[model samples]
Target: MSITPTPRILVLGASGLIGRFVTDDLRQRGCDVVGVARRFSGGQRVSPDDLELPVMAMEASALAELIRARDIGVIVNCLGVLQDGPGSDTGAVHRDFVVRLLSAIRQSRRDVRLIHISIPGNETHDRTAFSTTKREAERLIAASGNPHAILRPGFVIAPSAYGGSAMIRALAALPFELPEKERARPLQPVAVEDIATTIAWLAARPLDDETTKAVTWDIMQPEPVTLGDVIDRFRVAFGTAPQPRITLPKLLLDAGALAGDLISRLGWMSPMRSTAVAELRRGVSGDPQGWISATGIVPKRMSEVVGARGASIQDKWFARLYLVKALMIASLVLFWLVSGFIALVISFPATTAILTSRGWPEAFAVPFAAITSMMDMSIGVLIAFRCTAATGLVAGILLSVGYMAGCAILTPDLWREPLGALVKTGPAIVLMLVALLTLDNR
Candidate 1:
């Protein structure tokens, strides 16, 4: 079958995972693509060579000028950074550059489709100064009266030309402590391709169709996992049994996070800051179903991007996988003990729901909760004693996975979307992992 003619699309931040995926997807779809970056190799309009450059040069001031000069039809602004530091640049791109570009687009005869990728978080996604700036940019886009879409992508994990992910994998080869929140808190890790497809769906969306109208959409991993689940996956991927470690009382790290944000405000940016600690712990995120309903693209499984991290979970033995699982569960029990009963009461159902959905009935609905609920205050005492951690974790994982497997065997894949695996169901699994891992860690 013949393909439809693709539009002329321009991507800023062309070196980023989202940007790169957007670049490749657009090119594959036959869109005429012009990439922009501050220090693009050979300093040319086209992508550079074998080393696989991130199109660095597009950060240049002349980038918008290039877009207008080239008569670009669509602009995807994947331009953003986590902090206010030197390398963590986004003020201009998010605030000034976008305003300037949209204004310029307004002056032109051809209507431009503007897609801005933003996240709603400050230090760790709770809407800090960094997040505020993005909100400002989004407001400007909406007020500009241009055809635009605001895409707020959740945590993105993709392969990079840079060595950050590799370093983590290398570190995993040795015994090291994973982050505290990583052990317990829920995570919404997303595949890069998923983000790309969502953007493309918006970018190439027909202007006349209400479905394509530019609006704000949250792009998230269909399923979220806990730090423990991710670490277990990490261990599996790297083929290691390294003991993970971490500290509690997360606020101790806040000062560093705040400082990092200040630093990122001025420089290239470091991904590790106290803010992430906060996010991991909180597991704050919105549902992506609205976007999926409107745009028709769901995120790829977190496992797909495991390749980007160079970590494979498919090979690890259950024992190795279960250790982090143990630690993670212990951690959650600690958090609940620390947070007290209200938190525990609210958290347990969702946590158990994760187990139940999989195939583990005791883990899921009745007898387990009934048994736990029936236990007196002394039961909490027994849980805190530590002797029960291993048995609890083992029983939980088996019941959960077993039930999930049984259903998968009996049901169709379509019916399995929300029940199959942590990676299968969407963000809930990530939360379940967090609750369980922390309880194990405790």
Candidate 2:
């Protein structure tokens, strides 16, 4: 009896939500998986504390050489960007990267099978960057002579949410009624595990068959559910009562999209951008016959999928606490920035008066106030970034302790204020500590 050798598979975007699962799935099937990403730090090849696959962390220019050196037989392209944010170019990622990758594969002269993950609908007229670029990439893959399989999945639901999935989870967790227009859109949410399993299955399948090449499959759930119905199901899973349905006018949604675009321009990845809104409004349901026929795995209904993976107490708390963390960080940032502005610009008189009342010299007070304001602003900026969060937390703790000590020596009576503003510092310090501990090492 002859034993088939394990195929060497290269998974792009291995750190991503879908990529991680796919990498794990392939590895579990005893395939030799090499995960590739645009960037990896501290001599890290694979994702820290996630997967054990060997990884190549380099630029696109080095991809061909790496593939040839590693003898990768199958390339699973899971790389995708849903939104244009800081350092994220949607067109470049979706279109340019795929073009470069395909060219490299051809140039390397390796018989590599390409499995590309894409969206279902190919609306040529769609102005959304996501749809336009994805379609372009698909066209490139089809044109490339290399054997390839394109899987267009609808709404992919995972254990955790990120990007549009995160927004969907957030909306479902909301206590208020959803906008009527959004409720009308239909979606067939597919489980991430199912998608991963399918990818693994495809990778192991023989690619010598000519008919399977350049084929595209619309991967989705068996039944389509309204957007509103999906949210209601999530609400039930999260142990929340279904809120009353309300229709939001098109005008309001449009206005919100406009505002969201402005926010995105400021570098915040807002889900309400016009492109995202348009995509959501267009709906996400696709024929699943191809997927079922290809893999012989019937996709589960959204209800069954959600029910099996129902939100636990920990999940609910995490969902709610995520919002609380955001609000707390925002509040802290605002408080520090505003306080700095008051001391540095608006209320210098009051600040000087307070310092003078404490018997500080005029020369010392001015520089002292300026330095304090700058330090406050610095702390706020530091806390805003994940990389500098630990530093910021430590600085914040020291600063808070110093301030409390100074207040005890000087304005001790301020602690007795009815607002309990001074008392709140203890909780604020604790919150910062909590955030620091939970910070992502990525």
Candidate 3:
């Protein structure tokens, strides 16, 4: 397996939570690791050695060329989406991508070992599109006749959190109790380190090792754990004292999922999507004996994995503000949209009258108010989309500042207005700054 002296290890979706950790762990172990992601920048902890490519968009031939050119001996595919939405298609990411990947592996004519990360569930239990498509990918990989190992990890707890893990952390930090049904649901957890270790172990296996090749195994702790058990562990880790907790009704959870779905269409990958709730309801559990027998690695329990040490200040801040961040962004979007709509549509004449009062001609003031109102709405639109949210926040902040300054110079009397309308821009500006600062998803 190590014929090339320094064989290359390519990790797809390298910017992701699990992908980032796996890529770093492999490189630290002296493996020639090349990471790939849709978009990577220095701020995102992307190594200069990593390649920035939209891997999901690549065809079989393109993938084959890259695999051959890089002399990639192993590929760890960590690319996946929680649900189908804007810029995320479960079938495309899980099923179609795997088909192309298998074809590319054959065309490359290299002894590439595919270490695919998948969910832990059987076909009958695969109700959501995310689980269904993932199972389909597993089937394709098993039938492809490639040197491969499918690792179905259960409730992965990683240091770098996102999606469901982040939501769990938020819930743990907050002083609230989950419903009895959710609390009692089985949730077999596994540390991200164990998954990486399993992959590294498989990568070093001999080509003729029948046990490790073309095998699908569930990689998780053997001991049974529940959802409430995980949250309590996290609360202990955060050093939060026990208090009277209000249990939320199932109806509220359903509403949150619907809202999450709406936000996902705007390109924001909220973990509260209906599919996430569906999968959570199904619970996470599997037989890990096969993985244990093959790798001889004991999986770490939840306590050992997440609650080994007290939470740091940064960790506490992240856990507390995770869900609040979404709320703050949503509020800002609505604030801008409503403010613009009020000025343009609801009170168009009044909007221009204020300008005219400052010795501005009626004709010029009318169009000026109209254009500025449209600009405000445009900023809201920008902030609503994930890719341009930062730009929109910045624009909103600058425009707010401009408005404050312009009003101060031209219409100082407005500052003395009873409603304090001009002064309200200050708080809006501050909110936009906060949103811009906390915008990074990683």
Candidate 4:
């Protein structure tokens, strides 16, 4: 299927992770692409010097305006969300959004073709927040009686999203040690480009064919890989240490689910509910036979995409590996710097007080005097916070405490109380925290 260079296109949610790439793909392919976003249109206004594309930065109401104004032939509802944010509800994300967008499209004179990207198992209770809401949106689309193509994509785990976030990147880096029972279930992971390619291919197909086409397609890499196996490959690909992957029993999982809910309420990342836990544990068995028999679009495996580039996003995993290494190094450097600051803050002031009170500058005092004594005992208040919060608070403490300790060491007998100082240490505290909140540290 070949599309002309200038098929007037309108892409909603163009600023998002996938939408940005999809728009870039269409524009590069010579499709007259216009991005509809909340911000200014993304690329250069379609010009000789610039890729000169038009991006409409407007709310949904404004998008309705673009539909009427541009005579847009196709409307790609690329809007979706993940991660933590004020407006990140998956239910409202699509349920309301799809209802509004579809209505607008139907009302428009342009026989607008719609390409909606959906994740697989969207209707399953075991499905995560994204899957559940997206599933609902799909049902609404079917009822819309409008021409539409719904694509159920697998784990995109792109470098951009995966690299910037903690959980996804950590998942890719760590090797799984799942219990034998848990490992029985399977997951067929796909690369990010597979998504871009899927869209490009679908974009080229006639809307008539696409509309009467399959309601859902299993979009993934040709070869299916298990969750545990990918971790091993990730170790070799990134040259990182094997991570601990433990599978908890129902009893432990139930306890964790409760804890996760409580923490999320306090604005901490919560663990999955029992339903979600079951979905992850069970996953999907066998190849999604229905998906393949429908679209006939085979996805590229991670192995194929290791060095491949898609639209605007690079095989950023390669670069992302570097990013991870850099961040780890940077975090270590900040840790030490803060430790030094802590010593300055606590030790220096306490030493001065001791010296004035004792009227003694013990010659060997610096090494003998400990700085931890000068640290305010109150810093431990951070222990009550969730993992992310705890790390930030503890990081601040290390810097402040280390500075105090360093200063106090200069004059030992007066400021340093070895017995009192022995209780608090920057390194020891950080390590203890790393052990306590395994989710937050990485």
* TM-score to native of every candidate shown: 0.58, 0.88, 0.96, 0.61
Those runs of model 4 whose alpha carbons end farther than 4 Å from true positions after fitting are 1-3, 6-10, 13-17, 32-60, 69-71, 81-86, 122-130, 161-172, 210-215, 222-225, 239-260, 266-278, 285-296, 306-442
- Summarize candidate 3's per-residue lDDT along 1-442 as a digit string, tens digits: 6363436889999999899999999888888899999986556655676889979889999999999999998899999998888788999999999999999999999999999999996679889999999999999999888989999999989987888998888988988788999988889999999999998888787756888778999998999999988988998898874756789899999999999999898999899989999998999989999999988998987878787999998989999999889988999999889989999999999999888988999989999999999999999899999989999999999999999998889888989999998888889888888888888887
Predicted candidate 4 versus true structure: per-residue lDDT over 1-442, tens digit per residue = 9535434777777666667777777787777777755543333233332222232223456556668887677777777754333434666666777877776776665666677877665354434665667778888888877777787665565545422222334444444244555445556666656676666666666656744344556676556666555544554555543546555465765675565555445454432444345555656433455555555656666666542333232322433343243233335435544544565555655544555556545553443334443233223323334434446455555655665575467445424465644345545555545434432211
| Candidate 2: Cα lDDT at 29 | 77
Residue 75, model 1: lDDT of 81
155: Cα error in model 2, Å: 0.3
Hey, what RMSD does candidate 2 come out at?
Answer: 3.5
lDDT rank order? 3, 2, 1, 4
Q: How many angstroms is residue 83 displaced in model 1 relative to the true structure, after the best TM-score fit?
A: 1.4
What tens-digit string does per-residue lDDT give for candidate 1 at 1-442?
9654546787877765577667876778766777665544342335532123243333434444565677777888877754554444556556876767776676665667888888733333445445667788887888987788888776665654222232234334446555554466665666667777776666666766666665787777667666566555656566665565444344545664675455344331334465454444556355677888886675777676663454334322322343344344445444334433432465666645655665667633555554444342233333444455434444444544654665567434535455544344334335345544444210
Best by lDDT: 3
Model 1 ranges with Cα > 4 A deviation: 1-4, 41-65, 87-90, 120-125, 161-174, 179-182, 241-268, 274-284, 307-442
The lDDT of each candidate is: 0.56, 0.75, 0.89, 0.55
Please report, as a residue range, the 10-residue window in candidate 2 with the lowest summed lDDT.
49-58
Runs of candidate 2 with Cα error greater than 4 angstroms are 1-3, 39-61, 242-272, 383-394, 410-420, 434-442
Stretch of 10 with least lDDT, candidate 4: 48-57
TM-score of 3: 0.96
lDDT tens digits, residue span 204-312, model 2 = 6666866676688888886767788887778778867556545557787799678767645545555577878888888887888877987798787777767555688
Residue-pair clash count for candidate 4: 31
